[model samples]
Target: MTKLAEMQCEACQVGAPQVSDEELANLIKMIPDWAVVVRDGVMQLERVFKFKNFKLAMAFTNALADLAETDFHHPGILTEWGKVTVTWWSHSVKGLHQNDFIMAAKTDELLISGK
Candidate 1:
């Protein structure tokens, strides 16, 4: 299997299946900073990226949006003065998908690449 960051997201349409518990556990290991959480009783993944100022925070958010567009999977992003909290889940399936973890890895790549 491709590394999560090296993979592209597959669409999570209404009938799509969420990732298996085994799969999610393995993938989450690749992005340890991310937390598996329940929101509205649906499982999701979240992580907060910190920055020195609002400008850098917004820059990260924009880069993340661009990445999401490429993958056709967007996350819920909260841009604050010095941090951006990103939440990823499959809205249609209402749970976690491989795409969510893949995008989470890509999000970390954004910070590492400093783009």
Candidate 2:
């Protein structure tokens, strides 16, 4: 199994993969501060990485790009002066998939390490 597949909730294991939209909504609602969102056919988790200037932001963007490429699960990244919006959705599925949440968790891990 892939890394994402290996990441299973102990109690929720042995069931169907991925989550329904209603399940997703309830789960997301519980995590009121995650900034993880689903809308307009996208599953996104946005984080504002603060930096002193635009150069630092660009550098972080490049680093994030490298990480995305290594994972083979890319996100829609919008880099501005001090923030980069990362939206992760499985294009093949035409909706949110398990990979999207896995990637979001991985991205959050990355931000923690960068700090």
Candidate 3:
């Protein structure tokens, strides 16, 4: 089976179908560390990675920023002194998508690669 991080994000249109219950269940397994959240009534995927120092945190953030630009799907990223919180959701679809899960997995991949 193709991993979530290995799946490329397709262009999500305004009326694209969000990941359904079954899909969410499967994708959730692919990215177990991510927490499903509802903010302003829209579903999202979030995870926070702990770091030992500010420099490492910023490095991860910068890497994610570049990845977001490359993927054309940006995320809500907060880089703090010892942690980076990443929130991924499809603003166009007004909820989570397969892309969100894919990006979330990719984020984790980047974190591990950086270490």
Whole-model Cα lDDT per candidate? 0.90, 0.62, 0.93
lDDT of 1 at 20: 91
Against the true structure, candidate 2 reaches a TM-score of 0.65
lDDT of 1: 0.90
Q: What is the RMSD, in Å, between candidate 3 and the native fold over all Cα?
A: 1.0
Candidate 3 least-lDDT 10 residues: 106-115
TM per model?
0.95, 0.65, 0.96
The 10 consecutive residues of candidate 2 with the worst lDDT sum are: 5-14
Clashing residue pairs found in predicted model 1: none
Question: Across residues 6-108, which tens digit of lDDT does each residue of candidate 3 receive?
Answer: 8999999999999999999998998989999999999999999999999989999999999999899999999999999999999999998899999998999
Ranked candidates (TM-score, high to low): 3, 1, 2
lDDT of 2 by residue, 1-67 (tens): 3444225322223333456867677645533445766688555555565667788778777877887
Q: Write the per-residue lDDT of candidate 1 for residues 9-96, one digit (tens) a residue.
A: 7756897998898998798899999999997899999999999999999999999999888888889999999999999999999898
Top of the candidates by TM-score: 3
lDDT winner between candidates 1 and 2: 1
The better candidate by lDDT, 1 or 3, is 3
